[model samples]
Target: MSSDEVRARVRVVSPRTSAARTRVTSIASEIDDQTRLGEVYIVSLMRSQLRLAVGVLAVLAVTLGGLPLLFHLVPQIGRIELFGVPLPWLLLSVFAFAEIIVLGWLYVRQAEKNEDDFSDLLEGR
Candidate 1:
């Protein structure tokens, strides 16, 4: 046989097939199946949400809880009046309520953002 013929006879044939390709699975299906990876994803989201809640609560606690201390530390603050109401009372009522509302809004917005991030993660973005 000639050298070219010998080379052609020894040519390789690849064994690759569709089965060799990586499988694509849906993230929702993985979660529905309660897979380990799914559980990890869920835990991560929960932890982030929990951390956010704790941070907000801490801020609320420090602001609200410190009011009494502030009043005691600065007696003049109690002596001042606003619209015929004691400064402390005004702050505790209107300011506290406004702060609570703002904090609640922040909490909701951040929670939604966290959920969106989690969704993006599941979608492989």
Candidate 2:
């Protein structure tokens, strides 16, 4: 309570030092039981998932963004008619959705794989 008393106490160990000694049953157990190593595993898994998501998004953005540039660079493609509509319109309506579907498939596959990999690691496989 007093400055002199507190200085005299001079605790050598942190109060939270005991928390690091808590042991987890296994990865199948509750997350609260996770030790520092387990926490690192979870953090790495999360980072991997985030990286996959960002990579998918970046690819999609580049693919979609390049379309207009392609049209502009090769103006003849814009004049090409498909079912009485400009090629760009057909591409925008058709290819855009197709690209989204493909990207969604890729994302789903990668996400599931990531989850499976994390699960296996946690399970001590």
Candidate 3:
């Protein structure tokens, strides 16, 4: 056949959807449903844990933020030396380190707990 005629014939043929497209759409919908369901199952647990974490941080911020003001209001307290540093500075530094350690420990513990729950869900336990 002439190239022009072959091209015209090809153009006349109906376009078909590939099997891959259909399979992909099907899998995408399945994943969407599973994700929605999993969120429903896990969201409350996650929310409560997040709230606890936020509360801890909030308390830490309030306490730490008040320190400088406390020092200013009562200069005598601030003047007291600990390890050759002012009491306020030493307390603030120690509290900052403690906050980091506490947060890290809590995050690891919560992550492990959440992963265990997710594994159980995935295994149909």
- Identify the candidate with maximal TM-score: 1
Query: In candidate 3, how many Å is residue 72 off?
Result: 4.0
Residues 1-41 of candidate 2 have per-residue lDDT tens digits of 69989987887566555543333235545345686766887
TM-scores across all candidates?
0.69, 0.64, 0.54
| Candidate 3 Cα outliers beyond 4 Å, as residue runs | 1-31, 34-39
lDDT of 3 by residue, 41-124 (tens): 567557756776787678777777777787778889967988898887777778678977887787778767876775565444
What are the lDDT figures for the candidates, one per model?
Answer: 0.84, 0.81, 0.68
Candidate 1's error at 111, in angstroms? 0.2
Worst 10 residues of 2 by lDDT: 19-28
Residue 77 in candidate 3, Cα distance off native in Å: 2.1
lDDT of model 1 at position 60: 86
lDDT of 1: 0.84
Model 3: colliding residue pairs: none
lDDT of model number 3:
0.68
In terms of lDDT, the poorest run of 10 residues in model 3 is 22-31
